[model samples]
Target: MGDDLVDLSEMFARFSEHWSPKLVARLNDYEVKLVKVEGDFVWHTHDDTDELFLVVAGQLTIQLRDRDVVLGPGQLFVVPRGVEHCPRADAEVKALLIEPTGVVNTGDAGGERTAIVVPI
Candidate 1:
């Protein structure tokens, strides 16, 4: 591991794209990422692993077929494997995503919005 600290605000300021995730750190097989999002995302599911979302700024709504899970700053939610979910934001939001390395952002949907996570 690197000796320097990872400042989230500084890392977030390095990019301006929406729905794209930037890698910040790694823990064993898991990766910690930061992403900016707005509007609606595609309905998708990760068949093999769960997705963890931790909101850092603004509000995020994880839309499940049954209900919507709303999250704010400092809040987090895990979308289980094989469960379809669509994330929406009325405005821009900054969030941290924790998932196994190589997991695509769009999961099984595989459309234009599928992001290949890059390091910040």
Candidate 2:
């Protein structure tokens, strides 16, 4: 990690791909990631680690097995470990994801949407 301050806006502006997470910082065993999301993501679960979603812009809807958790800018939600969920957005949504260093974005349902996170 760099000693310099990270500008989220600048990091976001450097990328344009949806579903791909860009690493911004590291917190002990966790990674702070930024991702652009639109449309629907795959239904998946992380059995060992919980996933955190913090909306930076636009709106996000986390479609759970039983209910949908909707989040807008400045809001955040933590999807507990082993809970199935799919993230959806009506428009473009910029979000900050906090999870373990090697946690896969697609969890157990990996496919095309799986992101290889690289620092911005």
Highest lDDT among the candidates is held by which one? 2
- Candidate achieving the largest TM-score: 2
Candidate 2 backbone collisions, by pair: none
Give residue 33's lDDT in candidate 2 (0 to 100): 96
Model 1: runs farther than 4 Å from truth? 1-3
TM-score of each: 0.96, 0.97
Give the poorly placed runs of model 2, Cα more than 4 Å off.
none
lDDT of 1: 0.94
Each model's backbone clash number: 0, 0
Residue 97, model 1, lDDT: 95
Please write out the lDDT profile of model 1 over residues 2-115, one tens digit for every residue: 556789899889999999999999989999999999999999999999999999999999999999999999999999999999999999999999999999999989989988
**What TM-score does candidate 1 reach?**
0.96
Candidate 2, residues 33-110, lDDT tens digits: the string is: 999999999999999999999999999999999999999999999999999999999999999999999999999999
